[model samples]
Target: MNAPAGISTLDRVKIFSEITIKTFDILVIGGGIMGAGIALDAASRGLRVLLVEKQDFAAGTSSRSTKLIHGGLRYLKNFELGLVRTVARERKVLNRNAPHLVMPEPMLIPILKNASYGYWATKAGLTLYDLLGNVETPERHRMLDKTQTLAQEPLLNPEKLQGAGCFVEYRTDDGRLTMEVLKTAHTFGATCLNYCELRHFTYNEEKRITGAALQDKLTGKNYQIKATCVINATGPWSAKIMQQDQPEKLPELVHTKGVHLVVPFEKFPLKQAVYFDIPGGRMLFAIPRQGVTYFGTTDTPFTGNLEKPRVEKEDVAYLLAEVNKMFTGLDLKPGDVISSWAGVRVLLYEAGKKPSEISRKDEIFISASGLITVAGGKLTGYRKLAEQVVNKALEKYFPENRQPSGTAKIKLSGGDFENAAAVKGFLKSCQEIGQLHKYPSESLAYLVRNYGTNTKAVLKEACRLKAENLDPETRLLQAEICYTIQNEGVTSLSDFLIRRTGKLYFERGQIIAILPAVKAAFQKILTLGNGILANQESEFMEQFEAAVAFKNESKNAMVSA
Candidate 1:
């Protein structure tokens, strides 16, 4: 029952050689949140699992989410009671298991004179929401008067503000959560590889999938892996994988593009997260995090590159117009936007339904070739989706020794606290470490929150490199870079900046200042060549440009005019 040597990040070449010769009980494709969840569920149940991602983990839709682990209160408007209850209950499970990664945030829903729901109706809806989800907050839902609402969020448009409803929602770093899940799975003997692409599926004589042909993107070397079962948890790329099994079949999933914009808190400062009204019966969220106020998510159907979805000028203009209308005098422009992200939702294709109108419920599809595919679920419902997918795989392939999912009772990696209170105490202890090292309190707190119990390891690395005489900030950055490369399988610079650390999105302003230190850390620790370091730097820059592509597009358009 010994777990396979921890994650294989430090020596990937050795692990790659080993996995090619060893067979697994399950081979999971696409190491996003869903694949990570499936690997955790299966491995914890004593099943041998191998998970592969074409890019770095959480480099897709999983990283580019609105980043809320809520019960989907908005689903109540559509009367999707069951969906609300499932995700709400899962919300509590996530909070219980990963308190640092899934901290609670107070959400304010402003009631406008021309609002979709009146104050009373909003109250009743939340009442049902609480009853269904078993919401347990210090103070559940409260109805605030117009004066109280404005006092809480003075930036709201007060001309026609009726009131507001304050409730609890859990905020998360989606990419970090995915990494923690995969790491926990690795602890249970799951072999995971990022930057490993699946070329095609291998089949037995019965035409059932036996395994897959995979290629390491970094080494450009190919390997074949054998497994009894193969699950397509590829999220947006589910359709593409399914086509390999049945080329004549139509795509069962549709890609819906969601875009988010980040700006300095000084530009659009708010005390708490606000889910407010926009035109056309829709709404949006503006949440504050790490000195930035970020908001988004236009629900338009996407028909572009799946690997690289870009935020468009129209998408930014739409969000800006809506948010500006709701918050008086903000007058935020493209220049105010420091960074932005775009992700595609791989949803179940329902005829004649708009992207916004489609249900977020996940469905399992088993093709004639025994390829099991899961499509269309929310970020909060990932564990449940994984449980469902695992159960079906067990029921079909390994019926003799089926095991129930124990993920709910287990903590994710870096979330080994006794309880929520203990997590807070741990954060306090992390700040003491910062004080000892003369590190900024804010930076230390950020590390503790994102890395959870693993912050000690980061600090240990920082201590080891103290003789380098680097600035405290740069030293800390190098320590994080080292930690992620050795442990989190950070194969490239963008992976560290975007997913592992979240500096690219939340702390965009500091990226340029820290780039040199980041490159130095990677080079010193991994002995990367100058050419490799340059390529990684160029890739990171491309990611940064993608975040501001919309603004650049407008500038290009103006020049053409």
Candidate 2:
């Protein structure tokens, strides 16, 4: 889709110019889901907002989540009814507003004879879960007998199985969701610049924050952005940014690491999503998306570098062991892992509690310098968190100009369809367009689902590339690349593969197969010199090799053991 007028384009020079000249009403530091949601919320309420990210949007913990817009069912086990209700309600709102990105997914929690929670207890929990979330009757929780549970997912282990609790959750494309929110905010006149780092804050006589000094990572150029209120929504890095204001205060964040492993569908073949408790009393999810099944998330306290969190050998081993035990006659080895990702969850520090015991609730802190900092929130609760943060900033800075948030009702970019039926109609229309372009039906459906109303724009770009003498598949990928670069502010090949398309997790082999064609298209469209292209290629290769090596090393270690 063509960028709305006055919205900054992907060009760094133009964005820098706008940031230098304009004094925004709200400056958001960080472009993850929190910052993106805050920008959208504030901008939709008529605030002149500017969002700056040190890296690509969702390049951090936002993209590394379990990819579920789920109510915290496990939190119920902790007696945190309030968190569950809030997340469940927010999940409904997200599914309603961004149907294209968040889709209903049925999940099964298998009950075993030796399970921590007995059958009746499990049923009661799910019943309360459904009621609290106001789940529709058709999608409400149901108790399935052992035979029925196995039928729903035949691969599940039958040994010592009692039954299963089935309920509906929503799955999402985390990175795409963040981008769409920012895009919608842009449509409402929010200026967002990725690859821009907030170096320092500008202060007034009374030490009130007036603006920020930013440095563009790509161009190495500095720019100043003045705003009436500056918000620090930097997720795991929130403490570091807060320290810039007051070095004497102790850090309030305790970061925990979560890791996920992806395996091909043919290898795992999970028919439905499964939430199972392991021997350690921690829960894990095995969810199917596209042609692969991904299971995650080992939560352990982490003190390592946050930016480059890799799946450690122990993390992969624990997941593989649990998955193998949960499945029937299937012994999953380390080699089964195609790709892995690790992310840090910035949680509020609670003394005398384990990492998993720390609350996921967000906290807002205001420094004496008038810098508003928000930290430690879940992805599902991002919109509500943003609303609260924006409201606080407005109340503190613009008390006379406070506006009610309209973000809960406003559709995200590419999410303007009237309903799910409308989305289906859009997909059907795209299939018809695909017929005219000789595009595959399945590929066209993928595009429509991923791009929503913007499928037409992507198809237009594909049609324009038909004369390039590329293969059908390459043409489709080239079209997406072009659309991403032109529209999504994708500056690097990694951003396109990892975040924009999710090929890194779901289609790792396909990415390797199409790398050459993708690189060629990138060079042609970006007009990058060979030196710059080489550097980008080197970086991509390093990441690709690291992922491959992680898997290979695990397999080798297992074999040696």
Candidate 3:
């Protein structure tokens, strides 16, 4: 089948018009990782699918993850062997399919004298972890003595460091992964819309759900979309959507907030990804990427705004304290943080469990109104969650032509390479294009890593705009902006900066420097007026500042006094 048309503003308007006029086989609410996976799965099965997101794809928990595609080795501590195995197997599948995006990174688990897990206990756990997850012998756990561990990553605290566990874990760009899945779903003929809000559900005489009332956040125009099946994969907002259907039902989600802080490599200089425990036995990661080290994830109960979860001063203090304790040589402080992000996890409401203790296992709820809702899943398990959700939908609504999920065998968008070697060869070839276009080797390699097989398309666009006489960096940025606006449904600058490319997290300086050029390019291509451009810029800056800000007025005043 032919690939679907690129997702521009015009394409979005076209899709809105089409979905408004016809009934679809499935209407998927929320365009995060899980929803994107569901859309792809259903569409690959020959079902007409429509997916809508209130914001840009992966603008929530999906984008704000710890960015690991690992087997959830930590879950084994709680005796969740099944989840560990499932995520480990899925990690292999993701690495096989999206080699350019999913990469194997060596993780170091420091064994301190006062560490929660002793040397032998940690080894036993890791051994069981490897066995249950079917880890290859070569890629399995390795016991690193204190000298070897410190040699690998010299920043570790050596005062009481007994040894470490070195193992392989898959790292990924979560937002880009979600986008590729959504794009692949579109390729398979699923119509998807970002920046589209769901107003309410439409029900038939028996009160069974039949359709959705959606409003385009950009155009402020409303449209009604009819569908035979509607799946609610709204992540943290699943409770809100379910409440709209059954107001009497108690809320089923416990919102746990996780935050990450990014520090330049010069300050921390972590050579490998380290998963170390804090004072309270909770684990956090400090992974190095693009000349920076980022670590996170405090699991506190969140009662704040879901749309804009800001990193608080306490959150930063907690992370910095943990990092300093583990890496004693690094005297890191809140001031060292250049950027940060907070995300809310919509975990199942298990009575009497702490926030971190809640299970990451996904659960699906089918309301009496025929509204199918899925909640409480990790990013690593999105495909299986989607497969399960679609299977149930098919059994209930389309039993006559039931089909199993094809996603496992098929590669995601831009992930058609046969193996990791093929990906390396492709990247090596891309360097020639970079040389021809005067693009830096590093920038081109970054694009290849992020876009995979689609790197050529972006390069072609960059070549087409070579006459613009842009700087090497600006040219690369322009090419990405052009590709995103023309093909990736980037309705706003924040979408392009934060989700499409992770400039907000990794390339903050570049984003600020090229903001004007990017804005002009979007305006010229999408015909966005000055007012819209200004609003988008303001919103992007506000979000950028909120993510990085660490000082609270009240706290600062008390400290000073």
Q: Write the per-residue lDDT of candidate 1 for residues 1-561, one digit (tens) a residue.
A: 112124545779998989978889999998999999999999999999999999999999999999999888888877889999999889889988988899889999998896668988999998998889887666489999999999999999899898999998899999999999998998888989999999999998999898999999998999998999999999989988999988786457788999999999999987889997676556799999989999988999999998899999999999998889889779999989999999999888788878887888888988988889998899999999899999999999999866789999888888888778998798888888788888999888888788888887889889988999988888888888888887789877888899988888988888888788788888888889999999999988998988888887999999999
Q: How do these models rank on lDDT, best leading?
A: 1, 3, 2
Error of 1 at 476 (Å): 1.7
Per-candidate alpha-carbon RMSD to the true structure: 1.7, 1.8, 1.5
C-alpha TM-score for every candidate:
0.97, 0.97, 0.97
Better of 1 and 3 by lDDT: 1
For model 1, where is the 10-residue window of minimal lDDT? 1-10
lDDT of 3 at 126: 89
What is the lDDT of every predicted structure here?
Answer: 0.88, 0.86, 0.87
lDDT tens digits by residue: candidate 3, 1-561? 223237666577677778888889999999999999999999999999999999998998999999999888889878988898888888888988889999899999989896679999999988988887788888899999999999998989889799999998999999999998988888888988999999999999999999999999988999998999999999999989988888787456889899999999999888899998776557999999998999988999999999998788888888888888789678887777888889989988889888877788888888888889998888998998899999999999999866788898878778878899999999989997778767888988899888888887888777777788877677777788888877789888899889988989998866777888889888888898888889989999998887666655435767999
Candidate no. 2 TM-score: 0.97
Candidate 3 C-alpha error for residue 390, in Å:
0.6
